[model samples]
Target: MERPELPLPQLHAFVVLAEELHFGHAATRLGIAQPPLSQQIRRLEDKVGYALFTREPGRIGLTPAGRELLPAARHALTDLADGLTAARQVGSGRAGRLRIGFAASVALTVLPGLLRTFRGRFPAVDLDIREMTTAPQLAALREGSIDIGLLREPPAHDTELGFETVLDEPFVAVLSASHPLATQRAVRVEQLANCPFVLLPRTVGPSLYDQITNLCIAAGFTPQVTQHAVEWQTVCALVETGLGVSLAPESIRRIRLKGVAFRRIEPNAARTRVAVAWRKSDSNPLVPRLRAAFDQDPPDGPRRRPNQ
Candidate 1:
């Protein structure tokens, strides 16, 4: 037998009648008269070539066909309603998922607090987060894999990406407790020239590594780089073992390594800034909510600039 085409309005009428099990209440719920509601159901049954409901003198009950069709009818109506609601939300700039990428270092500081606040305010919005380095995050944002990025510094890639400062933090020197300079009130970049250093790999971000190295040169000598670690924690861990000293942003203190002691790097030579970045051409309605996550007031004083 050929399958009959099911019209949406008739399907809607069938769903209501199935739930009510009576013509009068179903008509009340549908805002129509009982006779018209019955007429619509008869037309639906004729189209399907089967009696959906068995009507007795004072009672009505679903036939086998009605029972079988009930679930599909409910599902179709529900899916249609959900699709309409989603479309309306997008049209009004109120719904949809937003993918955000972040560097591991930034995740330790402003990202957590900002996420807590955003989750509370926009509970309906779906958020997807990806952990990535600054370079990869920039690439993902440009390629549309991500909508926003919490990056250490603004990318030097292209003018199509927009950056907004979220946090400005100064780099601090981390050394083992047994290191001689650990007891100093505050150490300058020049003072650490002779100490062995655990540096970030040149491949991680060459320009950033150069910025750290150049700061040492400005203090009058090249650093004695003993080892290179890819991530900040790895470098700091090596420092904790008394292998060498390292320069890291203040956010690294949150790690709380047992043997590590953090102190201000005098002259603020290696201070770094973090920002929320996104594509310049993106016009997604959720942009404002994502931006609100990091839109706190700037702290008073001279803010730190990026290495570049």
Candidate 2:
């Protein structure tokens, strides 16, 4: 046999009638005449193929069928209500996962505070954070796998992806506390010509590699490359052990690596920027909220090329 459709109105009428146990009172609560309420209850019973109520000597009470349906009816209504609310919240950008990509250095600087504040406002948003280099981050943004990127290099103006500089500060030289330059308040880029240098591989970030090499060339010397490390912390660790010296963003000082001292680079040509990148047609509405949180002055205006 074909199942009858359980209309919302019929279920609602049955619920009210079951609760009241009196036709006139239920009809009053439902804002309808008693006769129409009776018809609705009859229709509800027909649909379920069961007697929902029993009447005896001016008294009315539920049959076993009505008692069984009560809880399910209330539960179904509540589920629908909650599901609708969730949909609205997602549409408004108040809830949902936001995939974020970043170079490891920013994790120690603004990233932690930015995430903490964003979460306080939108606790329901899941932050899927990935530590990626500038190149991979740009590719991820283009491929739609990530929503936002925190990068160390400036990206070219592309029609498909938009980029902005969040913080543009001059590079600082990283040295062991025992190194001769450690006592100097500022180290000139030309001063490190003969010193062994530690660096991140070009595959990790080509733009930063280009910036460092170009700065060295402008200073009238080629850097003597001695070592390469994968992460910023490792680079700092190498310097701390007196293995070699390196150039890094001022923000890297936040790591507070022991036995390491950061000195401002002279002439300020070797500079780096902390940038934000996203798809030009990014569908996630939360991007604006994120940009507003981190948008501030870049201590040294904007980072320009080393040659410039």
Candidate 3:
């Protein structure tokens, strides 16, 4: 058996004829002359190798084949229309998937609120989020594995990417609730000189890692590196087990993780200047909308400079 290829125009004509059950009415519905409509129906019937409709002098009725094809034809037309709509939406960035990589600290910061706002404005943009440290995020961006990255500033020379700063947050001390400093209202950089420190690896987020150590060195002692983790929550988790103290952005306190107490650090100008990073040549239009979403006010407070 061979399948007859139905052209779209012919399919449309058949569907209209099936609904109207008369050549004149179907022609009127299609805004065409009855003679032309009749000619089109005859051509379709010839190709189909059977009469789709039994045409009497004044009335027309669908044959068994026409009835079966009516539903299939209607479904095919609907599918085609929907597919075209989807194509249009995707082309305009009104609907599509955006893969984004973020550091875990972002969970406690402005990223969530930024995402909510983006969704509110563009509900059709699907977000694919991955929690990665700054270093991995850089690699991901260069590899085109992610559309954007929410992370702190990279070193001056990692210039293969573009970036937009979302917020500048101050760093604070994060210690286990059971640790001695948990009772204190705040801790100083010098005070932590000799304590075992749980830190994010330098390979992951060099900026913050150097900031914590440099601040400690300036305060008079090098920290004893006791543990390292990439994700902020994991770093906090190790602290919960009383592994060591860690320096984190002030926004991290919002995580509300049990067994951890966050204290403001003194005399140290340490802070995490978080930014959204992407490939320099990346052309996904969704990226701009996302940046616009993040450009809004920081969720927790008034706008502050990097030092704030």
Candidate 4:
């Protein structure tokens, strides 16, 4: 047999009346009339199939069943209060999980500092960080796998998502330390026109890939891509072998391969940007709070290489 549902108001009334052992006093404490408090207790007793109190002329006392249920009832109310507090904390973005997707290369630049400061400010926010390329980050945001993304070359127009550029840096040429170009102060984008190029495949980062290719075209030549590597480290390694030259965000300078040299690209007109993106429809409270953190302490500005 299924028991009838006991209302919270009734349970609360029972606990109060049990504590006071006086209907009038309990009613005073609960901010209710004596009659209503007595009625609430009677209803709760009926649901539990046990008499919860004994009433005699000028006397009131709990029945054994009431004594047995008191501790459990009090514990239940305490747990409910605690649960509500935690829920409110999460609602306010003070405590909750925030899943963040970021590009692998971002780790070489502002990512570490951004995370350190954000953790200090919101220690209770559990950060779920995932390393992914731009396309996967966008896909994750759309499907709700991630709450936010720090990626490069965000789409110029997207109605479903909001993007804010956090870092914009000029392109630098990656050359073999022994290559003749490495001896020059800077290399013109067109100078690399005849050099075999090392680049990441277009499928991995289509927006950035297009940006680089278009920069080359604007310089009056399309690069002859001779090798493909997914990561900047690999691209630098390939460049070190003198297999080809490459163009990368200035931040890639952090990956110091002994055989690889970074040179400022001439014209300096082509640049790549890192942007933070989130779905506009997302209702996560932490989203805006994290956004505020980014705004307050934007990623460390990219370091410039010394004059050659």
Candidate 5:
């Protein structure tokens, strides 16, 4: 025999009747007349080909089949209600996972503090974070691999992405403690033009590296790059070994290394502008919460001491 379609109204009537146990009261609770309520239950029982409830003069009780099915029925209805609520929240941007990408540099300074504040404010949101270079971060944002990105500067191809400045970080020079300029209170970009430098991979973004090169040019000579590293820490490590000097965002001071010393660069020639970026056409419900996470102000900026 073919199975019959389940009638939602009949199921609803059965659940109400099971709770109230009295037809009149169940009908009142359902905002329907008693006859219709009874008819609904009878229809449901007929569809199932079994007596769901036993009825005697002025009394009602669930049969064995009804007792066995009640728990599953209630669970189904409750799950349906919860699913609908979650869908509504997703539509309104109140719920869902937010995947975020960040440059290695930004993660060291602003990302940590911002994440703590975001957790406090939006505890329910699931945050997925990935460390990527500016190029890959921009690619991830455009391809929908991530919902947002914390990166340095605006993307070179601006038509596909939207950017908002989150912080402007000044450039600083890092070198081994034994280096001559490390003892200076503050060093000028001009003084380091001839020093062997460690450079970020040109693949990261030409404009960013250009900012450093342009500063050296303005200072009167080109830097002699003795080494290149893909990440800031590796570059800093090379600087610590006395391999050469490097220019990095002032925020890099937050990371402490035994042999390294950080000093401010004079005239602030190359400032790194960190921005929160997203795709122009993509819309993720959790974008605002993710943005708020990066915008939270800390009681103090990352600690930087001239001699530490």
Candidate 6:
């Protein structure tokens, strides 16, 4: 059988009375009149189904039942107080769990600094960080699996999500260390017309995939894509093996493969943007807070929409 629910006020009164063992002193400690304190103890005992105190002329003491209930009631009250404190901290955005999904490429650029700033400001917030590609990161944000997304080339029009540009970086040509163009201070996009290309499949990142292809077209030749790799590092590795040359974000140069060389694209008008993305309908307070971390702006900073 289930025990009756005990009122918090009654339990509080009972604990105070048990500690003082004197109605006058207990009432004083609880800031209540003696009669009401006694009445609360009686109500708690009724719920507990036991006599909680023994009373005699000029003397008062706890019965065995009262002694047993004291420790449990004290522990319950302590736990409740701790839980309330934690909830308040979370409500104020000072402490809580924030799940962030980020592109692997940004880990080479913005991710580290963003994390450092957020951790410094909100030391109590627990972070669940996952490395994901643009497509998966967007999916996770919509599904509520991640609170924030740091990704490349967020879609230009997505009513379901809000985005802000965090970094705008130019593309660079990646070549094998021994390739002829590797020693060039800068390479024009059109110079690679005859070279077979290694590229990321459009399925993984449509915007970025199209950006590269469109840059090639603007240079007057559609890249003859000969191989596909999902990650920038893999693309660089393929270039290193002389499988094909590629173009990637300037951040890709940080991968540091000894056999790979990165050269600036002359007239580097084609730039890639990394953005912070979140569901527009998201109610998590941490979402806005984290987005600010991405921009190194205050939480109230001006909002930048996708593709801006």
Model 5: residue 110 alpha-carbon error in angstroms? 2.0
Model 2 stretches astray by more than 4 angstroms: 1-9, 22-44, 55-59, 295-308
3 or 5, which is superior by lDDT? 3
CA error at residue 251 for candidate 6, angstroms: 0.9
| Pairs in clash, predicted candidate 5 | none
Q: What tens digits encode model 2's per-residue C-alpha lDDT throughout 207-233?
A: 898888888888998888799998889
Residues 123-229, model 4: lDDT tens digits: 98899999988998999999999999988888888888898877778999999999888999999988888899999998889999999999999999998998999
Q: Report how far residue 308 has shifted in candidate 3, in Å.
A: 21
Better of 1 and 5 by TM-score: 5
Q: Tell me how many residue pairs clash in candidate 3.
A: 0
Worst-scoring 10-residue span by lDDT in model 3: 299-308
Candidate structures ordered by lDDT, highest first:
6, 4, 2, 3, 1, 5
Candidate 6, which ten residues in sequence have the lowest lDDT sum?
A: 297-306
- Candidate 3: which stretches are off by over 4 Å? 155-160, 177-184, 257-259, 295-297, 301-308
Q: Roughly what TM-score does model 3 have, to 2 decimal places?
A: 0.85
Query: Candidate 4, after superposition: displacement of residue 120 in Å?
Result: 2.9
TM-scores vs. true structure, each candidate: 0.81, 0.84, 0.85, 0.87, 0.90, 0.94
Give the distance in Å from residue 10's predicted Cα in candidate 6 to where it truly belongs.
1.0
RMSD of each: 3.7, 3.9, 3.3, 4.5, 4.7, 2.6
Taking the tens digit of each residue's C-alpha lDDT, what string does model 6 give over 36-89?
998898888888888999999999988999889999999989988999999998
Residue 141 CA error for candidate 3 (Å)? Answer: 2.8
Clashing pairs in 4: none
State, as a TM-score between 0 and 1, how close model 5 is to the true structure.
0.90
